[model samples]
Target: MQANSASGMAVHDDCKLKFLELKAKRNFRFIVFKIDEKIQQVAIEKLGDPNETYDDFTASLPADECRYAVYDFDFTTEENCQKSKIFFVAWSPDTARVRSKMLYASSKDRFKRELDGIQIELQATDPSEMSMDIIKARAI
Candidate 1:
């Protein structure tokens, strides 16, 4: 019985390794956007001195399978250096069907505008709500 259990464990490990190898060989790719310092400055400048705090800006959008937006912000401060916050936004597709799609600039707007592009067939979509963790994982 002990030998049989050991063999089962080895088989499981081998299956996992084979699955990983097949995943690596696939043509899976994710879109990457770099939030440069200049873009961060622009977004903050546009936001201005609003009464709302960072929490207010982080609220999820209330929409169906319509246009959706996501904001990612990072704050950093160093000794004797000015504190700064960076922001990025991504928009979802306009179709009634919920699915993940590539985002592109909708216009020359400085508000980090986003528009839907081609849809990724294998990507999952959350109609219940937009989740940062899920989006980041899928993007990766």
Candidate 2:
């Protein structure tokens, strides 16, 4: 029965339920909602956009497995709704225990550049196209 906090306002359970339903209807799912500040910092630093800051992100993991993940980053505020930048990652299968080698980069352009010559198990704007293929996915 914990209340959700947004902009210091106490949002009740009913509102939370409705929000979840709406997200589902939109084909959106959260992979890791609250990324650690350090991770965010490192990602931005490595991505070469040091000044950009994102409060949170929503990802489409699609299948129960974390084979391929696509994320959209944004800063949520009442004054602005800046969004639509995407980050994608390909995770190593659990049997390999190589999740630590997960590779992530932003935008399809960068995704192509960074992951070039590296075989991708899946690639599409639609998450429904992702699969469980894990071969040749040398994690960065």
Candidate 3:
């Protein structure tokens, strides 16, 4: 993981590894990430089971904190064919501190760059902004 001189934060090595597992191996349905302010590094906060619902994944995030996440959304296409798309989510809730939001905003690009094969990206400042409807719309 390379450190960003601007934010002084680096993504933990495991972030990319877990993402790869999700991408190539279907190991997890979703992953949540947080920046460890004390260590100044991004760390894996949680991993969702393969069968976890979107609600469960959303519940894992704190109501007043910022986070980064990747979700593997599986759905049937118009032809009834099964398909999956990987979504990279930047979750900076409105209630979170400005500094926290700023840190996440600054570090997001570098963090995302490390994970290869991401298909979609979402940036949300509220739960409604990242709802299932939005996910589905983006996947299409």
Candidate 4:
């Protein structure tokens, strides 16, 4: 899998981390996990195949204060036609119904922006440090 870097360099199997800025002042982030051999062996013995689906891995995750959503997105470019990077966005499930709605609204807003030709930049970054213009320019 080829990764698209802000510097225009290609990285293979790069782990993606994502963060979202919520209006409620709570921070949310997700990290793409790489399940190694040891974990796989253990899972095969105790649980089913962890590699089967993200849901399998999610089931193993210890319950936390937050809920979660695990999914991957395929990213491809003309220069990297031979491969596509699967970026995982593991969103924590919010217990508060209002906050849950807010999260959905934020995602909807992002999609709308993309449809309008606006850049969708959910970087693994401090919201204060993120520059929408810079992220938008990187797409070009």
Choose the strongest candidate by lDDT. 3
Screening candidate 3 with a backbone cut-off below 3 angstroms (N, C-alpha, C), the clashing residue pairs are: none
Q: Write the per-residue lDDT of candidate 3 for residues 21-76, one digit (tens) a residue.
A: 99999999999999998889999999999989999998998899999999999999
lDDT of 2 by residue, 107-131 (tens): 2233233222222333433333332
Whole-structure CA lDDT of model 4: 0.28
Q: Better model by lDDT, 3 or 4?
A: 3
Model 1 weakest lDDT span, ten residues long = 1-10
Span of 10 residues, lowest total lDDT, candidate 2? 41-50
Between which residue pairs do clashes occur in model 4? Answer: 67-92, 67-93, 68-93
Better of 2 and 4 by TM-score: 2
Candidate 1 TM-score to native: 0.27
Candidate topping TM-score: 3
Off by over 4 Å in 1: 1-49, 63-76, 91-96, 99-140
lDDT of 1 by residue, 1-140 (tens): 01122112111132223223323432112212222222221111122122444335333322322222223222333454442222223434355333223222322132222212322212213332334444334333
- How far residue 11's Cα lies from its native spot in candidate 2, in Å, is 40
**lDDT, model 1:** 0.27
> Native-vs-model 3 lDDT?
0.93
